[model samples]
Target: MDNLTHSLVGALIGQTGLKRKTGLNIPALIIGANLPDVDAACFFWLEGVEHLGFRRGITHGPPAWLLLPLVLAGMLWGFDRWQAKRGKRPEGRVPVHFGWLYLLGFIACLTHPALDWLNVYGIRLLEPFSSQWFYGDTLFIIDVWLWGLMGFATWWSLRQEKRGETWRKTGRQALALALVYIGVNGAISTYVASSAQAANPQATQVIASPLPVTSWDREVLLKVDYGYWAHVESSARQDLARPNKISVSPCRLSTATAGANSQLDAFLFWSRALIAERAEDGSVILRDARFYDPRARDRFSLALPDVECEPLAPPSP
Candidate 1:
């Protein structure tokens, strides 16, 4: 998920009565929510495509989940002490409790992975121990509706805070609403995916990803013995039995091995379901059916001429 979503969730967590537990708890929550993204720094040193292999890897794994929050808590604790010693601490600063801050940080950090797991982009939750990627296929990377829910709850909470009303209920309510939305979407994705797969008995694997902005729309990717295919259909349609539109040509794998390259490797590693189509010039074009956009077919695709693949036959006139 996006950093803004993570931060907003962190703030919501803080508003759930955790903020009053210790000084700098808000910072712990917000920072810990975004700390797993520290892996993004690899973009500077790692070239194009390499970052894909690296991002959402170790930092999001179990070890980091346990340790990163502690690191954040320690930093917040140290900063508070530093401020106190310099006599620069704010007069209203609450007595800092290191353990409570760590707890808050850990709780905030846990939310990061849970929310991230709600999106199509996969995360390696058990990294180091395992490199397997897990996908929720529940929501888009960014959902304005979710933003509205969290944002409105935040705004309402702040309003009540000014009036000195119990604002924790608002945060808790928002969290509950978000969970319900996620549960509904998960059910929809599951039903749609099953329907799509049942529609094509030949399809060996099916990945149904919910589309953004709409609740019942889904982008379905299918893996056949020969190649991959994709389509978008509405779960809200009365007739899910209606024929699907195959949005792109099936990318057929060649008899020869597609040559290995960094770009192709990274794309293959990240793609959940895809196909390899041979170009006329003996090159191979790998497209992830999951992200195939009719308007931008080339996007999320990798073309490798160096990788040797069986040459495609001349076009049938």
Candidate 2:
């Protein structure tokens, strides 16, 4: 989910009876939502040091979350102590059920990677012990559907509850909707994996994802790069991988243009290093260029805002 969605979720979660304070639970939700990205900090480009996928290491690992509760509890305790000394109570302290509050933070933080894994991108769920990346290729990084379904539902439900409506009713309905989305996408991913296997039973196959765009809608891409030449299945409604894969090895975003052969080269210039790729036939392939994709291409792949193109160099004179 994007920052806005995250903020909204935090706010909604704040409305819980568990959160008696005005601002305490909201901050927890926000922190929990973003806590996973902390791994990005480890990606320090240096003059002497080499490059490494920081998140695929400790940050995305299962064991790394083991300390999440302890860290959160300590922070809350320190805050409570500070408030006592000042004789001015803090605005957002979880007065009761410290254990449950800490637990929620841990789960919120964990959700980041769990959702991240659903996308075609790589994540190291079990790090230190292994560096092999596992990608569910489940959903798009910043899908609007997830925002509306989870964050939006949470907000509306909370709002209704505030006005003496039934929070339980709305929350249950929201949960059911969310589960359906997850289940449908999960089934879709399996179908994609099967399609890849049928393509080359002799080869070892690994399925990537069906990035969620809405409650039950998603964009799925399957990459068969493990064997000889790499191929991709950029399917919408469960299309299979074709033999002829787009061979834009080490491509750049600057190459995106209609009827151009610089397909591979153009994607490289974009934030491929920071996002997922959804390749379509030579026609186009969409990626989550959050830091660079100005139009939020996730909205509509072909709707990306135009950027001035540098002419491909003329043939040698």
Candidate 3:
């Protein structure tokens, strides 16, 4: 999920009466919601596809979940005292309760990874303990519909608060509706994927990637043999349409050469459906079948050693 979605979720959680828990509870919620993304700082030191392997790992795991909120709570507690020392504390501010602040921070931080796991990009939920990647494949990375739904509810809640009426109910209703929407989409993806696999016994895997702005639509990819076959699916349709084969490199990576390159190793670690193709210059190009695009061929690709690439063995049917 995008940062805006994460931030909006945090704010909505805060609007559900949690903001009254402490003087800086709202900030704690908002910042904690995005704290797991601090791993994005890897771009400053790591190059190329290396960040892909590092992101959504340790920082999003259990250890960070437990420690990050504690750190955030302590900072908020210090800030409150600092304000008091300067005689600048807001008169209307509620007393800062370290316990409540920490709870709010923990609640918000937990929402971050939950949202992140709902897309095709995937996340490492048990990172440090196990580097397994989990994918929800239920929603697009950025859903404008979610933005509208949660964004409007948040705004309406704030408006109701200003009017001194019950506002938490509005937030709760919005949260419920959002959950229903997500559940429905998850069901749709599951149905499409299962249907695809059942129809093609030779398929090793099937991915139902949600498309942006169309909750009922999905781009289905079936892994077979040496590559993948893709087609669009709509809930309104009665049957799975014919799928076109995706062009991919038939070259295989040299284990000895790839092991020596950190960049190639990182790319391999993060690529779920890796494909290797021989470039015009004889160098091998590696790409993931999940996100391969001709217009942006180099986006998630890396070049392997210049040695003659080996041919891939035909996959078992």
TM-scores for every predicted model: 0.90, 0.64, 0.93
Relative to the true structure, candidate 3 reaches a TM of 0.93
Task: Let me know the TM-score candidate 1 reaches against the reference structure.
Answer: 0.90
Using TM-score, rank the candidates from best to worst.
Answer: 3, 1, 2
lDDT scores of the candidates, listed in order: 0.78, 0.51, 0.85
Top candidate, metric lDDT: 3
Location of the lowest summed lDDT over 10 successive residues in candidate 2: 308-317
The per-prediction tally of clashing pairs is 1, 26, 1
Distance from true location, Cα of 71 in model 2, Å = 1.3
Which stretches of model 3 miss by more than 4 angstroms? 227-241, 294-296, 305-307, 312-317
- Cα lDDT of model 3 by residue, 6-67, tens digit: 99999999888989878898899999999999999999999978988899999999999999
Answer with 1 or 2, whichever has the higher lDDT.
Answer: 1
lDDT (tens digit, per residue) of candidate 2 on 1-317: 35565554444444444345322455565676566666656536421111223444576677767675557656765676777789887554436345655766676666666666666546767777876666665566666876677676777777787788866566556656765776777777677667666765543444444444442433322233321223343555444544443333222334345334233223332222222232332223444322223455433233223333232222221
Return the lDDT, model 2, position 126.
78
Model 1: runs farther than 4 Å from truth? 237-259, 279-282, 294-299, 311-317
